[model samples]
Target: MATWAQFAAAEPELAVYGRELLREEQGYAFLATVSPGGAPRVHPVVPFVADGTLLVSIAVNSPKTRDLRAEPRYMLHATVGDNDTEFAVRGCAREIFDDTGTKWLRAHRELNVIDIPLETVLFALEIDRVDAAIWDDGPPHRQTWRAPNG
Candidate 1:
């Protein structure tokens, strides 16, 4: 798996577009995890980058949190407007507890009215693969990247 910075370094343009799609003004993404029944459970999320790490926080006892702890595999889809442009990331989200993680979590709590940033569980989604499609007058352009070991 690769870190966000590494992905950017490998695919500068694709990474830039991915970041733009993820951090839009209405910043949102859909996090897909496996439910206890082995089905996909997707929920909207506010995903952010910290020191090249992709971190997302959820309510401590939320089903998604439990799902992640139990099975880290996930597919995170960035919100694309009417263009039908597809941008997505697939990876294993591992629980994190480091200074970088804490700093972001704290800042998040200070910036938002919600308590989840301060009290929720956080995980870093290491990039296993990235996919994007771009449209420019003609047929859409597709791009993809896989971690060196992924």
Candidate 2:
């Protein structure tokens, strides 16, 4: 898996477009996780990039949190606006247990006016793959990146 920085390094243009899409429209994204019964669960999430990592702060009691804890694999898709542009990332989440890391993420969240409660869990979404599609007049432009050995 690759950190956001690594993905950016590998595919600069796609990374920039993906970041723009992800941060657009209130920074909302759809996170897909696997339930304990092996069902797919999708939830809206506010995602941010901190310390070269894509992270999300989820309520500790949220069902998505439980799903993530039980199964780390996830697919996060940027919420499309009026356009046909699309961006998505597939990865595995790692829970943040270190106080310093969580504190840094919390501070960043606060700076962005993200209202994450204190009773929340932070997770790093390590990227295994990223895909993007941009449409204008003709055929849609598509791009994809995969982590080395991921």
TM-score of every model? 0.91, 0.93
For candidate 1, list the clashing residue pairs, or say none: none
lDDT of 1 by residue, 44-122 (tens): 9888887788889988889999999889999999888457787899999989877777788887667655455477778
After superposition, which runs of candidate 2 have C-alpha atoms over 4 Å from their true positions?
Answer: 24-27
User: Could you say which candidate leads in TM-score?
Assistant: 2
What is the lDDT, from 0 to 100, of the residue 34 in candidate 2?
Answer: 99
Error of 1 at 89 (Å): 0.3
Output the lDDT of residue 104, model 2: 62
lDDT of 2 at 144: 85
Root-mean-square deviation of Cα positions for candidate 1 versus the true structure, in angstroms: 1.8
**Model 2 residue 111 lDDT score:** 77
> Cα lDDT of model 1 overall?
0.86
